[model samples]
Target: MHIDQAILDKVNPWLEATFDNETHRAIEQMMTTSPKELEESFYKNLEFGTGGMRGIMGVGTNRINKYTLGKSTQGVSDYMKKAFPGKHLSVAIAFDCRHNSKSLARVVADVFSANGIQVYLFSDLRPTPELSFAVRHLKCQAGIVLTASHNPPEYNGYKVYWEDGGQLVPPQDKEIIDVIEALDYSEIKFTANESLIKYIDKEVDAAFIESTVKHASFNTPQADKDDMSIVFTSLHGTSITVLPDTLKKAGYNNVHIVPEQAVPDGDFPTVKSPNPEEPEALTMALSLADKLNADIVVGTDPDADRLGVAVRDNNNRMVLLNGNQTMVLMTHFLLEKWRKAGKLNGKQFIGSTIVSTPMLMELATAYGVQCKLGLTGFKWIAKMIKDFPELQFIGGGEESFGYMVGDHVRDKDAVAATLLICEVAAQAKASGSSVYQELEKLYVDYGFYKEALLSLTKKGIEGAQEIKQMMIDQRVNPIREIDGNRVVMVEDYQSSTAKNLLTGEVENLDIPKSDVLIYYTEDGAKIAARPSGTEPKIKFYVSVNAAIDSIDDIPSAEKQLDEKVKAIIRDLNIN
Candidate 1:
């Protein structure tokens, strides 16, 4: 492969004396022997998306290496100085079980301290939610976490959070990106100011665990807790650090861990992908649950910000629940609890993403609590919590296995979610019902909402362009029908407009602009197309719903919705 001049221009800087000898040797080897690999690594700089940056870890501008992380930290430091001039700025840092996470965290703290900023660094690996809590608890100006969420082992990431304990949004994100793009390799300060760095542990852990426990709403007797057998797996991530203790503190004794995946290994040896959303990732946990005859099985991602759950069905077989199902179960349980406790005064609301099942909105409406829709990421949900000061944020979640219980932690919290979910399971057991039975009751009361997600990954530079073109095609040439259902409305988030094709009218959508498109069918099906901000892929989300008259009708209704999703995918030619 021929290396373009632009790629060479980006790679030349690493050959300088400023970069370490190890990095230089790696780059030299790639350039000499692997021109194709060299081009992919140095073609362009890694993007600093709305939340933060993520990429393959290597020795290039496009990778998550020491130099790229240093530059990002320096840019953040510069922005902090400008954003809060003449003030003592401080930041907190945490890392997950990913490879080089601890070392990269130290490097990031070094950059922040070198910039004359105080740093509160975690003494050991911690979950992402704890990092968010530490930011507000310590009264720091910002926070950073080093983990790739659920990506493959070869990948890593840096997530930035503001004082509100939420990821960066709007003007702040753009401002930080501007500074990062303008920085040269020489501008990053790699030296450490040891005096300005403080190692924090135990105290923060106690506070975070306590806050998580307070979110539990279980009123079951001690006997119920003993009978409710729970199985959990961390997928070799940070959840193992806190979940067991949290569950134990919440009065659950019959808890078992999938020993194969309990150890925090960066390689994630037990699973192909450490994502709980994937069924294969939870295989070990489900097998263990089957052997132990456990009541419930839960799994969290690497950063412990997302959770996936499985429960025994009527046939007494362990079955995995989709992200939407988990969200629905949690939301319904909390809303009912609050209503019974007389906590619903019309000042409470739940949050969800637009791509999630609309059943959440219906549930909130039935309970007389507002439901707000954000974009794809949980950061938007956190931002909604900050935007609405008067309204109480009961809980919020997305369809990608991420959720938040209360306002304690601004980001999606798997630790708190896992504990509360177990409590819900226990409560159901006490009432002589199972989780699956409760879900059937919900569908019988409200409706059956089925959702499916299809992600198409395109690798490298050419793949990125292909994904962009796919989005463009969908935006410009909107589909008229799907599965014989006429498309009634189309929402183009990038243009901030919703067009009623049947009525020939246009209305404004009150939300931030993003490159996403949604189509609403006359039969109440919704299809959304959006590209991934952090990964090289385009995702399509399909949701179809039908009214269920009784629990016996669930199988047919589910089959119908499944067929509708398949038809929609076929109409869009997504395959």
Candidate 2:
């Protein structure tokens, strides 16, 4: 079954002739020195998956490089031509502060321009959401952002967006992938039509800032901006250029930026990873907060689509709130403000992914606003907006600190989240209450919901097979209990069906088939399992909730939730 060495030798010469000089050199170097590495890299081509191409930057087929980027762009350009022939094609391009990000963006721009597509390229780094916004704002046919989001510093990515400002879905994604698979080294166009590429910076920046600031309900609630000291960090990426000014414009004069992490550097020298989801990345901000007695510490990842916030607890120590908790607070705060502004019409609705805490649905139901649940990705939320024209999507978020406030953009927007969170904090401060106190009030009003996410990464070729087998095992024999709670239902997104464990009945699920499963308990506790789309990880999402009558029960209630999670992990045999 093994291929002959003679065939490989023959194919190697073809590869050298086909690839560009840099790519050929990289491939030759790896093949001569690290044969195993070369095979792992070039055995299979870089694929356009659910979120497009993302991987570590290196010289291999599996890694991201100018050649790979050019190939993907060429495929997309070719598809655009066939999909919309005899029409003027336009695509917007943006990037983050990752290594070689600007260079990659320019390469992509050149490829598109060479294909005779008009390009709207950002002159400087911008957030991912702004790229989504720009696609719609400029009426372009499609868009691209050079960012790996909250991934580690060694990684970079390229995300594609359609004219609707959402990532391509269904048929388009499949068609694009097919076209990319059919392409070879010769198919990629490297020549640049400089005249066709337009560099845009200040115009979009001003527009995005204006739109984000308008989302703020109460800008200046406190008279003394100096009293509310805040420390902010960009984690050595984008957001420094506008975030500080945005805070100042929102009437916060005493905001401090983390000096070591302020400048836009791709190396991310101050932190091991650029992800704001991890506490280590936010260490600089938290340290500054502790030293300066700041009210809040905020950090945004490289592309600024996700946010991390730390608030002072009763013990006067900074506590980093998880994604679920932050989303809950923002949902509560925004709904209240909208209701007070007489903006909560009957058509107003809020949304979150199925894996998010059910607290938002409970709260929205109480507020007379509809709570719509979508699949994990923000594109599904965008799909909902397209499907339901009557209902206005107020906000949507995942448990990963990504949130979107309005329909202006189709992706998770950290800028809007930043504006809203600060406004919420300012209002709480003006009322002489802490943000934690507001969270406690929400818990009391809408039941205490505590959720935890456990992600197990299985690396390399063998790891992928292991993850696949695990999914098969779970589907065949489902977990029936967690801490003695009776299992009520099992929602398998992959099958697009919900199984009634007791009654042995099945019902159809409305969403598309995805490799995700959720087990619901009779008492409302839930556990969800899914393999990550981008990384080599299988994630477990656990949620446990109880009704709280008073603030004093927070300790016991939290303990119970913790025990439930631990028990579930034990029963599930997760490593």
Q: Pick the candidate with the highest lDDT.
A: 1
Local accuracy of candidate 2 as per-residue lDDT tens digits, 1-575: 24447435533743666666776776667667766666556556666654567888987667888878888899899999998889899999999998899999999999999999999999989888889989988999999999887777778899999989988887788899888878886778899999999999888877777777777546465574557788899888788867787777767788989999988988888888888889899998998899999999889988888899899887889999988888889888878877988988789888889888989889888889998887787777777787789987788788988888888888888878887787777778778888888998888888999898889999766787899999999989888876678889999999899999899999999987889999999988889998887777899999989999998999999998888888878878887
Tens digits of lDDT, candidate 1, 1-575: 56788888888889999899999899889988998889889888888663479999999988998899999999999999999999999999999999999999999999999999999999999999999999999999999999888989999999999999999998799889999999988999888999999999899999999989888645767888999999999999998888898888878889999998989999999889999989999998998998999999999999999999999999999999998998999999999889999999999999999899999989998999999999988899999988999999999999999889988899999999998888889989888999999999999998999999999999998999999888888877889988898999999999999999999999999989999999999999999998898888889999999998999999999888888888888888874
Instruction: Let me know the TM-score candidate 2 reaches against the reference structure.
Output: 0.95
Cα deviation of 535 in candidate 1 (Å)?
A: 1.7
CA lDDT, every model vs. true structure = 0.92, 0.84
Measured with C-alpha atoms, the lDDT of residue 244 in candidate 2 is 81
Which 10 consecutive residues of model 1 have the lowest summed lDDT?
43-52
Q: What is the lDDT, from 0 to 100, of the residue 574 in candidate 1?
A: 78
Q: Judged by TM-score, which candidate is best?
A: 1
